[model samples]
Target: MIETIVFDVGETLTRDDCYWNLWADWLGIPRHTLSALVGAVVAQGLDNAEALRLVRPGIDLAAEYHAREAAGRGECLDESDLYDDVHPGLSALQQLGVRVVIAGNQTGRVGELLRGLDLPADVIVTSAEWGVAKPQPEFFHRVLEVAQAAPDETLYVGDHPANDIFPAKAAGLRAAHIRRGPWGHLWADAPEVVAAADWRIDSLTQLVDVVRA
Candidate 1:
């Protein structure tokens, strides 16, 4: 049985459409360009620093993208408007007596978002604070330590296969891939990603069954 459920922040708990479109508009770049650039960065296996460098030349990189949702323009982005589905799912999980945590590559902004949303989490493990990003063994290990959960006792739900599923499995956690439309294609041709995950789900609601089973 799963005692703890850890979630990825971006696509898993929140809909990021507004954020991306805002960035694309602010940079005067086509939305597709931004999307393609992100795809390229992921495909190239660029680290966060390298990814930031590549985008900085053309866009504000972080600030402009985050300012739209965050309360203070220059300050960190707040996620007060979490996706409609996420809050209910979380509440359900809590009602079921499962501990919940968030494990993602948030750059300190997610914490602010959580506070803004009034969503209190048991623990938060972010790459910025941990000094390591997902798909890295150390990242998952750090989260596991904070959650006080063995890999087998915890369930990691995330959208990115490489960043979420791959590393979680490597660190001994049960991994689930939350395939959200076009983004799912990233893993379609990669057998390793599919093999890494113990389950594949298209929606957060599906997690209830996965956990119950």
Candidate 2:
């Protein structure tokens, strides 16, 4: 039985349109171009960071990130950014005595923004704080530590197969593939994702029933 559900931020609990659109504006590229490049990179199994390189070769990403922050253009998460089902779904899980954790490959600042939303989750953490990103076994090791539950009893939910499902399953945690975001919808029916994901869901509310099962 799953006692804890750990969710990925982007495309799982929230939409990432704002994040990428900001980057597109910062880089002076059309949102459609950046978006298409993002899809291409993802389809090629390349990290989305590659999109930046594709836009401006030899660019310093960290410098640009700090510049954006300095310009007061940093990421800001609000209620509108959250999925409609996120609140009720997570709240229902909490009511069911199931632990809900929001863990994802996000910045420390994103964690802060998420906290500002006051969502119904037991814990909210990010890769920046942990110093370990997903698709890394050690990251899941840290997740299990944060979860305080056995791998078999924990469920890892996310849209990205490589960064979320694969590593979580390799770490012995059950994985749920949610078909939403670009990568999600693109690979929703892929044989690998289908085989690797213990449960394939379309929305967050399904998680309430998922944990019950």
TM-score of each: 0.78, 0.97
Give me the displacement of residue 77 in model 2, in angstroms. 1.3
Q: What is the C-alpha lDDT of each candidate?
A: 0.71, 0.92
| lDDT accuracy of residue 175 in candidate 2 | 96
Ten residues in sequence with the least summed lDDT for candidate 2: 204-213
lDDT by residue (1-213, candidate 1, tens digit) is: 888889887778766655555556655678777767766776665533343356566646556546654644333344543666677788778777788898788766665556566664677657887888777788888878877777798999887776788778888889888876334556644777777888887777777887688
| Deviation from native of the Cα of residue 64 in model 1, angstroms | 8.2
The clash count for each model shown is 1, 0
User: Tens digits of per-residue lDDT for model 2 on 1-213?
Assistant: 988999999999999889999999999999999999999998898888999899999999999999999999988789999989999999998999988899999999999999889899999999999999998898999999878899999999999999999999999999999998988898899999999999999988888788777
